[model samples]
Each structure stands twice: as C-alpha cells, then as structure tokens.
Target: MSTSRLFSVLDKALPDEKIIQDFSDRIWNDKELNGTYVELNNEWKFIPDNAPLDIVTKALFKEYFEIPFGTYKVMVAIGGNYKSGTWIFDSKILFCNALS
Candidate 1:
C-alpha cells in the first residue's frame, strides 16, 4: 500500500489516543522487540522481521502523534538479513503542533 493509504488504515484501525497508546505501549515494552527501535536525527526507526510488521507499524504510527514533527522509518528484515530498503515517512505530512 502507499504510505498515506497505510497511515489512513492505521488511523482507522486505531481511532483514538487511548487505543494508540495502549497498542504502542505493548510494542515499546516487548523485551525482544523494544531493542530494535532507535532514534536518529529526530526520526524514529525500527528494524523488525516481517512477522512483527503489523505491531511495529502501529507503534510507529502512534509515534507520529506523540513526538514532535519527524519521520518514522521502517526497515524490514529477517534473521539479521534486510528484506527491503528504508521507508521514510514523508516530511510533508503534518501533524498538530502543540505549541501552535
């Protein structure tokens, strides 16, 4: 799916902050998975195997709301082998600015 379409689906699937938070928290707290996430240049990126993409994608989607403006990158992999190149969230995608 396209990035915007993927995000739209995620928005529909997680319609509220509470649900997003709960789901993201689970991924953030996962012992094995949590270590896979990192922040670089204000962007949050995670490399996960294909099996966990759904959960990880949701977690990154939640990050879009919680963090200051930045990109979210996902790099899919398996058994320490990368399956694809990075998918960077569009910089043009705007979110509500708390300071505004």
Candidate 2:
C-alpha cells in the first residue's frame, strides 16, 4: 500500500522542514527505513492508520511527540497526533519538513 497518508502528516506539522524531522520519520514512501534506524525498522511493526501513530511513537520518545527518521539532509517520516490538527495541508508545509 502507498504510505502517502503517513507522509502527509509529517509534512504538515513541522515549521522548518530542513531543520527538523518528526516521528514516523524512519518509514519511506517506497520502502521501510534502513537498519540504521533500528527502533523504527526493527522494533515496531507499522500500523496502517495515522490515528495510532502518536500513541505508538510516544512509547519511544515523549519529548519529541514525534520521530525524525534520518539526520539532516535525510529521508525521514514525522510522527503526528491526529487529534492535534488537519491530516494534510494544501501548501503550507513541504515534504522536506516531513523528512526532516
């Protein structure tokens, strides 16, 4: 299945896409995040819905309230709480922010 939904959330949440990434960061649009990201790739199995994304991500790091998959200039997935805001933004946020 396409991970488009997951990517959408990440892109919307962050203020600066290049400066940061969020939870759900490890997962890519086309493939699973790499082994370097063991917590995401090795530990948690992906749940299909974004609703549960925050709860699951919280277990990893609460301070973030999200996940940043790769480091700067990287491929990442951002974690988001569906209750907090819209699932997708028309043009405000960029995919790079989600990948932060």
Candidate 3:
C-alpha cells in the first residue's frame, strides 16, 4: 500500500472524535457525517464564516469549518472505514474539508 493508503487506513480506525454533527448517513459499511456545514443541498456552496455567536453553538459549527475564514468543504472526516483492522485515511487528509 502507498503512504496515502496507510494514512487512510488509520484515520478510519482511530478517529478520536467527531463533533458538532447534526445529519449523517452510512452507505455500504461507510460511515458519514453531515449537517455540520450550513449550505445548500449541493455538495458545493459551503462557504466559511467566522463570526460572533454563543460560545457553545459557534464552537460546534467550527468543527465543520477548519480551513480558512471563508470557504466551503464537504466530507469532514471523523473516522471509520477499516477492513479487519486495516486503517484507511489514517494520516493523509482525513481532516481535510473540501473547498467549494
């Protein structure tokens, strides 16, 4: 396996935590999280905004937006997707929030 593959492996196996998750789904043994980003129905249009809010809710929303101040991302990885203890997305870009 390549380095990227190894990282992917561990990310799925040992995703320490998943925060601020509202909507989520799993497909064919794949675990997914959603509703963290405020955006349209499309995978795109997820813009970032750091503003003032209550301490708690804003912190919760921050989990989804981990990149720059104003951008969009999808598939903010938390963990899960291993095959028999083989971790995937372990060290590559599991925490990467896609830009849109």
Pick the TM-score winner.
Answer: 1
Q: Estimate each model's TM-score.
A: 0.21, 0.19, 0.18
Q: Write candidate 1's Cα lDDT for 37-70 as tens digits.
A: 5454698766332322222222333452556643
Candidate 1, superposed: residue stretches over 4 Å from native = 20-57, 60-100
Of the two candidates 2 and 3, the one with more favorable lDDT, higher being better, is 2
Cα lDDT tens digits for candidate 3, 14-72: 33233222213211122232223443455543222221111111111234646554332
Which candidate number has the best lDDT? 1
Q: Predictions ranked by TM-score, top down?
A: 1, 2, 3
Model 2, range 1-100, lDDT digits (tens) per residue? 4578645655454324323324344433333333122244356443332312221111111244345553323322333332335664321211222222
Instruction: Return the lDDT, model 3, position 5.
Output: 83
> Model 3: which ten-residue window has the lowest total lDDT?
51-60
Report every candidate's CA lDDT: 0.39, 0.33, 0.31
